[model samples]
Target: MPGKDAHNDTPRRVLDANFPDLALPAAVAARLPALVHCRRLASGRSLFVPGHRPTAFYAVAAGEIEARFTGLDGTVSVIEHVGAPRLFGLAAFAAGQPTEYEAVARGASEVLVIGREAYVLLMDEMPGFARALLAEFARRHDGTLRLLQAARHQSAAERFVLALAQLARERGRAAGDGWLEVTATQAELARLAHLSRQTANELLASAEAAGRVRRGRGHWLWRGDRE
Candidate 1:
């Protein structure tokens, strides 16, 4: 079976198809030094929180970021896991709204922070670059909606299977014998699947009994044959 480290090796083909060769324009890239900056985050550090005014656009340069929404009752739901070379937090910039989710680093990570003024300037002067990013935004938005719908309509076991497959695609890598692996705590999996922790645990145990999965330290193995 693969391990936690293998999760970082997964190819984001779904997003990558639309986001192929994404890059800032030369002029915009050059101006980034003045209008944008980079930061390194230790694992568990928050990049932004709900209700924060959008000051800048963010892109992950390395490592993973977990996006989560917290309800009025303080219940937290995992929205998605974003990996390196991907943009996030664009909703606030595009709509001029306060952020609705908290984005946290999943591990040691680096991010590009582009200031609002520069972001607008680039959009005006670099329409191609802007269009590319908009496509990514659209794709992410649709995916999020689908995940939410799945959470609302699917059974607990079905939701867990769906979430497991998604995470595997986004963050896992293949092991021998048609297995995939990812490094995620059961709590994180529960949040991602929108299931209670006990429900996730029970479902996973059933999966294991059915020979569809195997649990490991800080990670889980999924049988590709099953999903």
Candidate 2:
């Protein structure tokens, strides 16, 4: 659904709600250009690795990046996906800790790299900037924790339904064919729902038979009807 893309910070709807006036001073946006350098990262490239220290936190200019962690058993779990104007390497900026995960460009992406030192400089000079940064980081941390908990607790069927409802509210459009153009594969749906591929397939099969979704080429289109 086109409505699925409805986000506070998505390129379509720009909001001044960014960096709260509570923490980010109005003038701090001016300092961004001086502290940040633009960079183009190609698809499949690794921006940083586990155990590496970051010099700067990146603000997405365009395109998306995937954050993943490799388990000791060699399983790779996609931890998070970030789109434009979102912050990456925020933990490093906050605590000077080595990165715990790997960051890879999901596609050709542009980012503004702002050195931690420069950020610290600005934070010292601008209390608003420091407050905003810390507050944002805390919120993201909480969101990630909640997502992980839901994945761990929710079943394949429940997760699928929850995901569909969210997508319906966010991206679903008013197409007349009793279908919405949700161009996600079963595999991708599995990842998003934090379920295994086979389990995800089973859930979708039941839903399809029950008229909850319809499969199209390289995509899974959700139908609003539920049995």
Candidate 3:
């Protein structure tokens, strides 16, 4: 569950920090203050569930959100983690369809919610904003394609390593003594890598033996050495 937070003024620095890749035009940026709302979500709380119609575009202001897909048998797989200063829910919102994945808070998080009407208005009125958003969509599409290719062609160990590398790049923080810590459980990492828990455990054991990664109680530590 998300609690409403009254946020009438959204600062430009905040937007700039959140969307470093997207350069919004002054016109679009100026209008965002009035068009956005803020919400706070506690850990393990859902921002939105599958099959829910999207009323707004969501961007992470702080903390992380996990995108998960639940099957008919009620099994859940984590699709990806969207950390602070990133956007999510763009696909469904842009297509005007119900979301297929559930967006859940990975920790206490702050999110910027832009209503669908405001988003459409910005797109219709600002060329620069529209182009920037479309480019972001293209970039994400390319990343997805690359992941799919790796899944189809790479060896299981190779895929696991790649997945860990990607997570380290996205979610890792310096933990001292040349180690980078990633905030994810082994089971979550397995799902993100599209591997079974047993296989991921085996691969991780091999890596640990090689002095590459160390598994913490609820996280992972990597030295960033890929060789």
Candidate 4:
């Protein structure tokens, strides 16, 4: 109940304007307004959890969603942050399997929920559009796999720095003077980097001393590598 919201008539144009990553073709985009339901979530509430069968995949219209995996040993791995306009839960839908991760709202958020039936209908009616969506899914899956591999191979400090850099690339705003501002708290960063909070803080302090970044109250100003 904490995360639930009543559906509203959100326009397709609004969805496109808010989430550019969706990038549905014109025809498919035009039809989505009628086929989807909208939901709003409060911070830290779950959208779905492991073993639950979801009939819909979600696109974050606003805010962030964290997909986390918990092992039997109780170690929780933050798999990804699904920021605005990004899609999640597609692999489960494709495989017709129960969800394997817990999807939780990172803060106040809005999501566009496309049901399996509507998704299947669209795919059947628009092969090209389906191909585009599939391609996007493949690309993201590859990226996630790479990140997981990096976590396995990298040291904690290395993982923290690399995770911060990647977060900056994806979500940070240009703060001028070669710095990017990312709105992530220490706990969140630690989770993302797969480190304990104290370990993450120590690494951040060292980085700050080296002039690599300036940690702010609730955000970070990082001097990222030039790309």
Please give the CA lDDT of all the candidate structures: 0.76, 0.67, 0.78, 0.78
TM-score-wise, the better of 2 and 4 is: 4
Q: If both were scored by lDDT, which would come out higher, candidate 1 or candidate 4?
A: 4
- Candidate 1 positional error at 77, Å: 1.6
User: Which residue pairs in candidate 4 have backbone atoms (N, alpha carbon, C) closer than 3 angstroms, thus clashing?
Assistant: none
The segments of candidate 2 whose C-alpha lies over 4 angstroms from its true place after superposition are: 1-30, 125-127, 151-153, 158-185, 201-227
Task: TM-score winner between 1 and 2, please give it.
Answer: 1
Is candidate 2 or 3 superior in lDDT? Answer: 3
Worst 10 residues of 4 by lDDT: 2-11
Q: Write one digit per residue (lDDT tens) for candidate 1, span 1-227.
A: 33433322222321244356754456654554566556789999999898888778777767989999888898888888887667788899678898889999988987777677767766776547577877777877887887888889878777788788767866687877888888788887898998888999999899998899899989988985673
- Candidate 1 colliding pairs: none
Best by TM-score: 4
TM-score against truth, every candidate: 0.73, 0.67, 0.75, 0.79
What TM-score number comes out for model 3? 0.75
Q: Per-residue lDDT for 69-177 in model 2, tens only?
A: 8889987766666666677788975677899999889789876677865576667766666667778778777756755667789666777675555445333556566
Worst 10 residues of 3 by lDDT: 1-10
- Model 2's number of clashes is 9
